[model samples]
Structures are given as structure tokens and as C-alpha cells.
Target chain A: MGALHEGHLSLIRMAAAENHRVVVSVYVNPTQFGVHEDLDSYPKTWETDCGMLKDLDKELAEDGNNLGGIAAVFAPTTDTMYPSGRPDQAVNAKGSFVTITPVGEVLEGASRPTFFRGVATVCMKLFNIVMPEKVYFGQKDVQQTVVIKKMVKDFCMNTEVVVGDTQRAPDGLALSSRNVYLGTRRRKVATVLSKILRVAEMSYLREHRLRDELLGPAEQLTKLLLMEQHQLPPEERVNFEIDYISLADPETMQELDEVDETRGAIISGAVKMLPVEVPQPGEDLGLSDGPPVRLIDNIILKPVKL
Target chain B: MGALHEGHLSLIRMAAAENHRVVVSVYVNPTQFGVHEDLDSYPKTWETDCGMLKDLDKELAEDGNNLGGIAAVFAPTTDTMYPSGRPDQAVNAKGSFVTITPVGEVLEGASRPTFFRGVATVCMKLFNIVMPEKVYFGQKDVQQTVVIKKMVKDFCMNTEVVVGDTQRAPDGLALSSRNVYLGTRRRKVATVLSKILRVAEMSYLREHRLRDELLGPAEQLTKLLLMEQHQLPPEERVNFEIDYISLADPETMQELDEVDETRGAIISGAVKMLPVEVPQPGEDLGLSDGPPVRLIDNIILKPVKL
Candidate 1:
């Protein structure tokens, strides 16, 4: 539950088309975020979100059929969603939480271990409270969608889950609220992230074999982005800190070594926090007033298995 | 499922009346009965049962009303209900079965500890398959009703449970399939069971103090019947044996120490197999031919607050 974005709005459109009612719940669930994660700074544009819904409602209803079917937008507080105190206590009492170490142990899960658990718990609460016939989630958070699907199946939840494709910027960069934190020069460099992902997607879909064939092109793209597109000097090029890069089974979300029966690969990563020099050892880096940020991007590619 | 006795008929009738469609399941649920128990000989009256339902359907139709009523009778085979294997295996798996020990531990539970678990598992399967708006159970098994209620709450089942009161003979012996096993003389002796329960009810309503005020009478009545009521002389009074006489809380189904909260009492018991000969070394007990039938009886005393 985050602020309204085109990615989330696309999910709402999908929900409205199929279901009798569309209920959008906008709550920045505190349980899903780590103690150091952006729990406080998570964008929460409620008034603007409501305004967007009003505009969408009018637009959908403009076609004389009166499809104005937005039911309720729930923005619950932290206590209201996770009443048993924290996520751990909630999972302990319910014994019905989502976990797929078998699937999540690779890629995105490598960096954020508790990410899927947080997503699963909050989704379960929403499923129970809303009791929606169908719920929609954005594929922008591809790993989240996979985790939620497994949880729903394991728990025998009655709701049908629909995942809409990720909405991207004109430059192919995936839309994220964190993208707002980018400055003029950093924003120009961020375009390379999507550009690298596009290259990986094309190579994997073509006649690329598993390890040597796929890794060669992927490695070349990363090198090209750092050297040419970003125009980083040799010293600055060394500063590019990549979180994780890997091929994974699109369906199960499990990492692949040789791509056996691999339907697709979700190539994803985050640019690490930039280093800052300080006067004292204990002194804060304090780069900007806006706070530190990490830019993330992913491309879902169907592998051509030979 | 054991060949539709009057006990089962009462449940079917309640379902037909309340639900849009009533599915009278007739297959005997083998998983519920424990080993060494009379699972094999637990009655098989399906033909008669079906005829009874046909008559019931005719009666309902003759009234010129068929608003989604008595849709079908689902007598699924044992394999259909317990695809996993049997009741014992099913219950042990993840402890999914209803824990009726809280009530059973006190009264009838001591005699037939696993009885309620079997009942709950079979009932849950029935609820899941039928997905009925409402399911009906007999009050003859009062503790079973309580256990099922708790299970419904614990599992968050959507179906509503309706319990019909205990139906009895003019002499007050609780109607049961096992009653058929009672011989001419044994039949007369069976009336003592009901008479004792009624006495417990009277004593409870009359403000009887001590905890055993109710149990003492039932025990005394059983002893007197074996010694005097039957043709047996005082020395031959070993014909009937009392398994256990217990008083329990109606809500939690746990045994109570004293009759303080006496919102009522579920006075229940089982009659052990009688020895064939008195003062003889292992005579061939008539229990083999007639089988040492286990008969259970319960009476809910009016609330008697201490």
C-alpha cells in the first residue's frame, strides 16, 4: 500500500473492468518495511490520490453507461492492519503467512530477506477485510506478485488475484516513487538502467544459451552502461555498486543456473547508496535533506530454450 | 452416515427445512470410529433411509413448493470423504481435527475420546463439499454440538450450525441404533439409563448442592436396575457395568468440580460389556453373540446457579 502511481492506477483499471466493484486500499504498511527502510518517507499523497480516483471515475462514466464503480478506498493506520502488535506476532498468532525461501532465496530476496513476508501478511489482512471477489496487484513489484499468488493458494483464499504489467516511463525506466528522489544529473544516468535491461531482454529472447551465452551479453550491457551511457570517469565507474543480477524462473521465482525449463527471467537490481566523506567518524553522511535513496529496475524476459 | 438412524433423520429434516438445498449424506464415515469399536456393525440402513427421504421429498413437493429445497442426497463413499486415508491419519496430520477433549475429557470423552474428532472431521468435509448456507446436527450429542460450534469458530467456516433437540421414547431411553442390540430383558433394563438422567435433572433443578448430587443418583439407579429390575438375583447383579458418569460445562465441554454454574449439566455415560457368568472364571459372555454394545445417554439439566 503506497501512494497512487500509474502502475497502481493500471491495477485499479483492470479490477474495475472485470469486477462489479473496485476497492483501492492505500496504506503504507509499516510491517513490510525494515527498521532502516523508508517507512516514514514512503510517499502518501492521499488528497491527490482521491482526486485521481475522482478523475478516473468521471472518465470511466463519461461513456453514457455510468461505469462509476469505485466502491471504497481504505487507508488504515498501522495498528488497524497489524493488530497483534508487529508482523512477527501477527504471523505467530495466525500461523498463516506466506514464505517461499525456495523461490525468494534468489534475486530480490537475496538483498531483502523479510520483504516477501511483509508483503504476504499485509495482503492477507486486506484480503480478509475487503473480502473482494478479485484483487489486483502491479507487476512492477514482480517478486511481490509471485509471493502473494503462492500465499493465496497455500491458504485457500477465495479471492482471484490479477497482476497488471509494470508501467514504465517514456525512456523505459520502471516507474517508482523513489524515482522522485533523483536529481538532474542522476536522473539522466538512471535512463541507462532501463536501457541495460532492454538489452538483456533482447539477448535472452534470441538464441542465447544458459550460462556462457546469456551472461556474456548481460555482462557486456552492464559494462557499456557504466562506460558509455553514464559517461562515468574511470574512478566514478568503479563506484557503480550493483546490488544483484541473476536469471530466475518467472513462474516459481527460483534462480536458475543453466536455465532448465526456464519460462522467463526477471533481471532486477538496485543502484547502491553513494559514499560520502565526513569530518568525523560518527558524523552522518547527510548527502541531501531529502534522504538517501536506491533506484531499482527490472525486465521480465521469456527465455528461448534450445 | 451409518444408515440414517432417527438421530441422522432429525439432522436431515432440519437441513431440508432451513437450507435452500439439503444433501442427506448416508455413507457411514469409517474414519470417526476407533479400532476395537463397533465400526463394522454400526448399522447399515441406507435403503430404508433413501425410501424415507423419497417420502420426505414427496411430502414437501405435495405442498406445492420447490424453492431450491432438498436438492439431493449425497451419500459419498469413504474414499470421497477421507481421500488422505482414514480419520486417525487425517486427525494426526497438522492436528486439523476438532479438539473435543475439553468437553470429552470430562464426561463421555473419557469413554470415547476420539469420537468427537471423527465427528468434526466428517462434518467439516460435508460442510466443504456441500458449502451449504446452514448445516444441522442433533442435540442428542450435546457435546458434539459444542465441539462442532468451536470448530466452526476456530476454522472460520461460513456455514451456520443448527442443532435439533434430543428425541426419546415414552419411557425416556434415548433413541439410538444400538438400542436394537438390547434383548427383551436388556431392553427393559435400558430404561434405567434414562430414569437416572431424569433424576439428575430433577435434583439439579431442585437446588441439589454436592457435585455428585446428580451423578450419585445415576450410579444408584444403574446398580438397583441390575440387582432388582431385571430377573437377575442380587448375586447375579454383574450383568451391567458403568463405564463412567461425568458432569461437564456446556460451553467449553470441560468437566466441572461442583454444580456452581449449573447453567445445566450434560450427564453422559457408556455401559460396559457384562460378564456372562458371575463368580466364574471367564465364562463365554453373551456379549460375543449380542456384542458388548456401547450405549451413550445425555440430559441437559436446567441452569441451577449455586
Candidate 2:
């Protein structure tokens, strides 16, 4: 759970400013990962992450306003976490687990269906262990943040949940530890995810409903098709497959059929990029995944008042 | 959840002895009751219950051992408990709830299927609200006690669960608020429930397996049949029915085939009793259920050292 990226650091910064004590838990929880997903391969730069946290604490302390700093780093082992934690391993794991209804099975998206259960269970465990007054998350994982908020209310958990803004690179690719998995070929086209969301956001301001701008029978299908019109030319980047693009209710994560601006919405998408055959002139790419790199991104959609 | 019976008082006594600050929550959580179950009819003598608790405090304090008394009484209203509690009440009650797996559905008996879910959720709310260092439960509710113990460990909650002994009358009828539901005639036969368990215990002490003693082979079947033989004849008391007599694992609530003493077992039973037709001479039975009253009782089964 810790690469100590700016996105995560931003949440820590917000927690430091707002709370009396800031505690960070940096553990790559195994239960949250699927059998096929990146559990074994997930990032674990513990020493480096701790170092960055120390540096950030020092830098924030330099401001001399004397805000809260990291109080503790709870990094327990998988056995410790799962002593009675995982229900799936019922035979082996003796720990009891907490699960939310309907939401885990549906709202978390059909791909990683059990994802929220893992998240919810672990978060409950952490809340019980840490007994914190407030917990924090980044808005990049909007649906996760929403699910956790619901879980807290449903369980009557005594902790408040706060979401921080999504941090991004200058070129607009949302920063992610998974972004490191996007090798050169996919990395070259990584910004397309944000580009699509940007177009969807702009179209939302004019069209109001993203579904109208995207594929589907209803109003404004032409503008929707226009929004999907790839901004990058075929020669400019390798081909990539669009997994899905839809407007979703921020809280429920259910796809919005008739999108409205009353509570705003989220434009979420995923893309799978194929390996590049030829190197582009004057371009440098970091070594990452040579295989297809699947990346996801989303943006909150609301009309701006003049 | 309060009737101040001996079973409940024993738990209070234990909590008073062990904890630095003891707190008791007295809320008959509505979410745990089914629509048809005794939600409206469930006992609610708040004043009498509070008076008894005050007497308990006085009794404990006069010992002069100097320990904490009942720190607070969390008797929140139904609306407050389910403020965002009942997900099952998706439309009306909006409060979030917590739930555990396996135990609630099976251990609570198939009749009250949603019973454990309601119990688990409300207990989570209470745990979050009170944040007590330790909580006490009566062994009379064997499965509920087991479920809560697992929930605490699984959630990594920093609370210890302590179970108290089951309190019973001299004749062996378990003390319960529902015992009042038994009229003068039915109360005479109430001891039949414990008689069944005693026979089963003797069978287990001899046969080492409750399943064999209660049901199967021809030889043990006679003893097992005797176990089912009620002490009170039909003419002596109102008609009653045994719903089930099953041997189960203490923790998982799963039915046990072969008995083992290492972990012990639970011998649980339920009886559906008819109302007494005539008032017995001289004895007074408080008004209770006009219709049939279904009662349940259980005993822990362990091998006796010879």
C-alpha cells in the first residue's frame, strides 16, 4: 500500500494539517489482491517509503506552523493481519471477518467483484487496531473512497473518512504505482486516459450527461462519439484497447443512465495498451511492462458557476 | 437487551470484577428482531430494569473492594441506534450495520435466519459506541457468545470477550426474561427442556457422542428416546413440542457427527408450548403469551474425567 507517491503524501499532508495526530499504515495487504491480480508483484519499497515519509515530515515541520506529524507506522505481517482476518481462507484462517452487503458484489465493478469485501474487511481491522478518530483516502480511487464511506456508516464505525485530491504529472497522466507497470510503449500512450476524461468533462459542461456524449441510444450521441474520437493519431502512438468508459454515480458506482448535475458525477475509464514495435524519434521511455498495461482513471464532473 | 435476570447479572458481576471502568448497554435492538418476531411484545420495563441495575451497583460497591461502577448506560432510542444502522431497512432505517459470516445463519438456528445478522450488526454499533476494554456475555446464549468472540478477534478489536456461567433454577429450568412467558401450568413442565439436556449429557458421558445418544443405534436409541421423554405428562401440564435436539460445535455451530472433548460441544433444544387451559389451584402465573410460546435452551457438553 505504500510507494510514498505524491498522491499518498498529499493525503498524509491533509491529515497532518487537520488532525492532532497523523498515523500512516504502510502494508501491501494480501487479502485485497485477487489470485490473478498483482499481489506477489505489488510494490513494497518499505525502507524507501519510510525514508520519504521521514523527509516529508521534516519538510512539513520546517514550515514551523507545528502541525501534526506521523505518530506511528503500523506495518504488520500477513499472518498478523489475517490471524483471524480472512473468511475466504476459513479452513486455515481462524479470524472472523466483516462484510457489507450488495455493495461489494455490485458497486465495486464487475471485474474485481470481491475487491471491496477485502478492502472493507481490512479497513475494519485497521480501524479496530488503530482506533483512529479519522481515516483518509485519495480521490483517485473514487469508488473505493465511496464504498469505504458507506461501510463506516453501515458499521457505525467511530472514525470519519476524508478524501484528498488526486495528484498528477505535468503532462496530466494520473500518478499511480501501477503506472510504473506501464512500460515505454504503453507509457507513451498513458496520457490518453486523462485526455478521454478531459474530453468527457468538457462535454459534460455542455451536454450535462456523459452518456449522451458516449455510445448509447438517447440524446446527443454525435457529441458522445466526438468525445471518444481519439486525440492521439495512430502514428503518434501504439494502438490501445478501450475497456470501458461510462458516467457513474459517485456514491453508488452504478452507471448513470440519465446523468444529471444535481450532485455531479464521475467519468471513469480503463485502457489496455499493446507493446510498441518501433522506437519513436527523440522520445525517452522508462522501462516498465512490455506486456499489455491496463490503466484506469476517473474525474469528477460538475458544472462550474460563472 | 435487559431483564436483569440472574444470567444477565452474572455477566455484570464479572465485568465489574475485571475491568477498570465497567459500562452496560441496555437497548433491545429492533434490527435483530424479525417482523413477525416479538419486537412489539418484547419486554421493555426500563424503570424496573434501571432500578435493579442501581441495586446491583450498590451491592457491588458496598463490598468496598474499590473498583469502577457502571460508568454509563447507553440506552439510545431505536432511531439513534439505527440512525444509519439497518441496511436491511434500505428504505426507512439508514444506519450502517456490521455482520459476521457462518455463525449468524447456521448457529442462530434456521428459524431466526436473519437473527444473527441483526445481532452482529447491533453489537458492532454498541462496540463502536462504548469502546469498552472488555464485554461480558452469558453462556446461556452459547452461539451468540461464540459469534461475538470471533467478531472481536477477526476485526482486531482491542476488546476481550468474557462469558459467564448459565444461571438456572433449582429444578434446572434456565432463567430468562422469556421464562415469564411460561404460565403456571407450562412453568411446571419448563424443567423438561433441561431434563432433555441432562439425559443427553449422561448419554454423552457414557457414549461420548450426543448424536448417537439422541438418535441412531437401536441400543442407545432407547436411552436417546428416553432423553426425548418429557418428565411432565400431558395431563399434568399444557401440551408442548420439541422442535429439535442437535449436537453442535461450540464455536462454528456446525453439527457434529462424532463427539470430541478437546473443544467441547453444545446441546441445544427448543420447545413450542401451548397455553394452559385451566388455572392451577393456589398458584399464580403472570399473564404471558396467549398463544403458543416457543422457548430455547442449551448446555455445554464436555467429557468427564473418570
Interface RMSD over true interface Cα atoms for each candidate: 7.9, 3.3
DockQ of each: 0.06, 0.41
Q: Is the docking of candidate 2 incorrect, acceptable, medium or high quality?
A: acceptable
Candidate 1 deviant stretches above 4 angstroms? A1-11, A24-68, A73-132, A135-306, B14-21, B27-45, B59-69, B77-90, B94-133, B150-159, B169-171, B177-196, B219-246, B257-265, B269-295, B303-306
Model 1 chain A worst lDDT window (10 residues): A89-98
Candidate 1 lDDT at A281 equals 40
On a 0 to 1 TM-score scale, where does candidate 1 land against the true structure? 0.57
| CAPRI class assigned to model 1 | incorrect
- Native-to-model Cα distance after best TM-score fit, residue A173 in candidate 1, in Å: 13
**Top model number, DockQ:** 2
**TM values, all candidates:** 0.57, 0.83
What tens digits encode model 2's per-residue C-alpha lDDT throughout B103-197?
66674537776577678778887888787888888887888898888788777888888888889998888888877777666787677667777
- Top candidate on lDDT is 2
Q: Give the whole-model CA lDDT for all candidates, comma-separated.
A: 0.63, 0.71
Q: Model 2 over residues A134-241: C-alpha lDDT tens digits?
A: 999988877778878887876667889998888999989888877776665566567877777777677676665647664243224323433544454544556666
